[model samples]
Target: MPLTPIDPRLDPGVSAALAAVAEREVDQVFFVACGGSLSIMHPAKFMLDQHSAALPSDVLNAAEFVARAPKRLTKQSLVVLCSMTGTTKETVAATKFAQSAGALTLVLTTDPASPLAEAGDHAIGFEAPYTTGVPIDAKNSNYARIYQLVLGLAKIFDGSDKLGALMDSLEALQPAIDRAHTHFAPLFADYAPRLAKKDVIYTMASGADYGAAYSFAICVLMEMQWINSHAIHANEFFHGPFEVLDENASFVLFKGLDSTRPLTERAETFLHRFGATENILVLDAAELDLSGIDAGLAGNLVPLIFFDTLWRFAYKIADLRDQEMLEARRYMKKLHDY
Candidate 1:
């Protein structure tokens, strides 16, 4: 079965809470999460960095945030935390830490009954689909919900009426994503057999698309498929990661319609020079016709477009390799009491 979008409407209370956050004049936003949830906040952080510089932000590892306890985390700080399970010990602890620091804490999770959700000053619990048989759907729905919440925050802070149109643009994103899947699945299927043979891969992206590349590499490939992979930033590619490009290297580059697209293109050029052109798979957001979305908004949506395209390839690769995306865990939640 094909994937469906999560509800685009923000819960009224959630919207009201965020509106109050905006009204309170939040100066710094700290996104605290671990693993994939942490990766999902990158785009939101990027948006703040690129567009709303006045509202500075940081993406903090939940445990690290609790350890360091940044001095700037105060009543004026808005801490956004999320846990898919709502029970990650570090995240739950971080939520308490943030609250204790007088920071406004917002949490997104699937289980309202869990500790993290219950600890938050404002919690929005999403309905996670039962994807026991459709692992991809689970991820897709989770990603979509994150998109709504993150971009909704962006909309509030950006202080532009443009976000009104952006909301509609986002609502239409699922159909565009479905179209991307339909167009790319055959090509991805053909490539998956060969890709599945590789022991390691390098995923690269610039600007907002890096969120998708990072998530796909760590969350899906490393954690799910047990594949060895590295997520590299395009601008940082030449710094040291370029040394790994042998003939057998697999490179996935996500290009987006942003100022940093040229940075990724340069990396792609380097990849072509160092390896076979076919060795580099480029997922460019510009190729996706996000027609009703504003150019700037579309640029921000690069992560979503990239994730939608790349994860489908990953799902295909997992299928060809007979790997269970949900079952093969090395140390994530498998430890007895870690």
Candidate 2:
């Protein structure tokens, strides 16, 4: 596969849409997607939660959302639908439902002509920089593309200087990711395949990293590695699910600048209570300087770097093995029942 393609298509498109819609305060934000799109929406949920505390992050599995959560819509209700192809059944339908409710709907997608994109008030499409020709695990360009839109929004809404410093931070951290992958590659050569074949790998993180932890383990690792993984919020880990911990299972966690060390520490103590399963803590070694950026913004970027880097590194490793290679309809068809 070629060097992982970076998506630049949605940069100006999404940035401009957000700039134009800057008038909307977005009283309520609903993130709607199914499968991988929902997974990737994790970062946006985290950022929106932190930046727009006034706007609650409600991630709905599009079908369940329209069925159960339907409410009177105001211009305040902002619905962001993510579907790389712009044809996923759930996303397309939900965008229509959200619109019917009178909520403002936006779409982030790869296909501008897709039915899903057409349903949105604004459609942000990430132009893939390149293509991976391999039949399996071949196309993952959109994941990064949609991610840039989120980071770009960070620049506009959260005041990250319009991706200037975020890009710099990513550039600086890219090397750190390269180094970490080099170190873990060989060690994980055997372990990755082993864990990938297991029944499940549980990823746990509290606060903002929760969505990322879920996305990395369940979405990226499981989807790419062809394994089973699920993410959990840290505080909720003790609600009795820990009883299932065992040697056959694997447990994964993320360590980054804004990560909640104590909750994870508590999880560790609880995991010891069960006495099984291997534990891996992926750390963000990226040393970002916050003196230049706002203190509140610093925490968000640190973990976001880990989120951006870990999935890419995992995909690269999977690429060498030609695994976790689900693409749009062909790939997700097997994974999703709908």
Candidate 3:
């Protein structure tokens, strides 16, 4: 099979999967994953809920899930577990637990032999064009692919052809991705101080970018920024934490050309509650010609461009530092030890 780049495959598969969901009789979905996959998996989950309204979705960290979310594996639940490597220990355990409770399991993975894959009743395989965790600053091919598949799945759910234009648009995006790298150099340099200086670094995203925001914040905390950067959902921002958004915090809001508009706008409104505007940065992204996208496909992808941009930003930040920065985490370490 020809290797599919993460960015391209994500939109289509997600649409297709969601389409499949709509055609079926599933009542709920449980996504168990870690790292990039975990982060990127969310928008699809949200879109799935938003589009079909047929099922409720949950994206959980593999480790905490197996131990705490026993409700996920009940007989009535339909479990969709994702782990890029297909070998995350917690994911594997969760799948087995879900199966034991009589739930049907669908596994999405890069490797078929992975424990998660083997445990699932049905498994789908995808390959990414780029590396996952090779170098400090490399792109996450799987993360990109998840976005593509999620969008594709959504389109499939709606049985619409709208996503085709966006799928076609992928070939043209390379130049933009390349151009983005060039412009990012200075921004990475500017944020380098936070990596080396801040007392507490927190990353926030409101609305649609919340997943990417949460995922990247965790990455920075675990990989480079080296602090407990909480990923605050914009809706929840006003509830309590908005009070803390001050000069001490660094916030980044993600933008995509969709419902994210209202989400980002609302997020901006809350930023002022804490006087976080001056210190805030909106991740820059150009709107693509997704006019051809199917309603199903749009939800899957709307969040992807932002996810890719944020990951790239995190990747560059890691690159600016020495090898010691990324040397800390190597794939799904003890998680898949089984």
Candidate 4:
């Protein structure tokens, strides 16, 4: 069944908030968050990097941003922070720090009343399946909201006319995700036992999709399933990591239609010829039916769609290994001190 189509319009409050930021002198944009939240910021920064001609952007880990404060982060900067629960201590602290620096802070979280939200100058709440434990309208997800924010900034600062196209693309994201689930179901089932047996798994991607690889490796495999995993950029794979290639090595490679597709494709060709690893799994964005999305915007949206698809694979591996994917964390929030 097709998912309900999302309204191809920005939320009124989100639009108003961006308008308020446009009134300010924002010379730079910083996206600050922790863990999965941080991962989501990467594609936004990448999008802005590709489109915005004037405004510089950076994605920073929340704790690192607070510790190593950038000199450019001043009153003329806009800082965006995101957290699913809004209580992530590092992100909340970063938001307060940005506010103290007199930077305009925009916060995105599922919880409107979260400390991170309150710390920011402007807050936009979004619905997430992780928070709600049910499928949500794609337009209300963090990916969509953050992409909207980036597109809004581009439209205002770079004089871009891609927002309407972006809206159309976002509307198609959920159905793409749904199709991915159905398409990958049998493959994930077949791959689960092999993945579960692996002591370490390496994820690889380049360009805009790298964040999805990183989040799946760290957040899903390492944190949730307690597996050893690392995300290696395809652009860097040939330089050093490729030496580890052998029949025993396990990898999940993400391929997207972005400009850096060749980087991953090069690595993919090498992996097949030299790695000799039957455990290699490639999740290509091209495999999904994206006919509803704009051609120019579909590549950028790959991370969001890939994240959703990879999430199901994580669950499959977890079930195969008899590991509790979510509640079995040993040292995360349960620890009093890291």
* Winner by TM-score: 4
User: Candidate 1 lDDT, tens digit per residue, 70-111?
Assistant: 999998899989888888889999999998988999888878
Clashes of 1: 0
Model 4 lDDT tens row, 43-104: 88888888889899889999999999999999999999999999999999998899899999
- Choose 1 or 4, whichever is better by lDDT: 4
**Cα deviation of 181 in candidate 2 (Å)?**
2.4
* lDDT, candidate 3, 1-338, per-residue tens: 11233234443444344444444455566777777667766766765655544356778787777778565467767677777778667788878888887776767787878887789876766664333443322123444444444444445444333344545544444444455556655666566545534445566654456676777677655555465577777667778877777766767766545565666668776665665444566654444444434443443444555555555556655565443444556552524544
Per-candidate Cα lDDT values, in order, are 0.75, 0.60, 0.59, 0.86
lDDT of 1 at 230: 73
Best by lDDT: 4
lDDT per residue (tens digit) for residues 1-338 in model 2: 11212224345656555654565656676878987668656666765655443456677888878888656456678787888678888789998888877787878887889998788888877533222233211112343344455554444455543355444444444344345556545545545655544556778776556666776776666666655678877778778677677666567655444546577768766665564534444353343333444344444544444565465556655666566455522455565665
Task: Give the Å shift of residue 39 in candidate 2.
Answer: 2.1
Error of 3 at 193 (Å): 3.6
For model 2, what is the alpha-carbon lDDT of residue 124? 79
Candidate 1, superposed: residue stretches over 4 Å from native? 1-10, 127-158
Poorest 10 consecutive residues of model 3 by lDDT?
A: 130-139
Note each model's CA RMSD in angstroms.
Answer: 5.2, 7.0, 5.8, 4.3
lDDT of 3 at 203: 63
Name the Cα RMSD for model 3: 5.8
Per-candidate TM equals 0.88, 0.72, 0.73, 0.95
